[model samples]
Target: EPEVTQTPSHQVTQMGQEVILRCVPISNHLYFYWYRQILGQKVEFLVSFYNNEISEKSEIFDDQFSVERPDGSNFTLKIRSTKLEDSAMYFCASTGTGSPEAFFGQGTRLTVV
Candidate 1:
């Protein structure tokens, strides 16, 4: 079975730096999402993308955060400016039929210092 794949398992950046996290979701999935988890906190939804546009988003997705599918196979999340609070394990997920189950990647851990 195909699963979501994320690159550069971990990243470290400066407070004001820009960071791009990449993910290759399941090929047949139509719904793509980006979620984050602070070290010991609950998982939070950031945004969901479908049909080449944002389908839904949470308040956590602000001006500083943007997501795109530059290619049919890859989805990317770009953080314009990093902040300490932005550090978290970012998960890339996808679902084929909008079912309750979503496949997720291992996550890219970001650390802003």
Candidate 2:
């Protein structure tokens, strides 16, 4: 079965540096989402995109963050300036519909120093 894949499994960066987390969502899915889980915290939705534009975004998705579908299969999340609070496990998910059963990638661990 086709599954979502994320690169660099882990990343460590200093504050203020930029980082781009990569993901390849399930091929046939039309809805893509970014969610983050701080240690010991529940998963929080960051953003959702479809048809090449943002469909919905949470307050967590501030000016420092952006997302892109650079190619047919690659989706990326860029943080313009990292902060210690930004360190978390970022999960890429995809679903054919806006359902709670969306599939998740293993997750990319981002550590902002």
Q: Each candidate's lDDT (Cα)? A: 0.96, 0.94
Cα misplacement distance, residue 54 of candidate 2 (Å) = 0.4
Pairs clashing within candidate 1: none
- Please give the lDDT score at residue 89 for candidate 1: 100
Per-candidate TM-score against the hidden true structure: 0.97, 0.95
Tell me which residue pairs clash in candidate 2.
none
Judged by lDDT, which candidate is best? Answer: 1
lDDT of 1: 0.96
lDDT of 1 by residue, 1-113 (tens): 78899987999999999999999999989999999999999999999999999999999999999999999899999999999999999999999885769999999999999
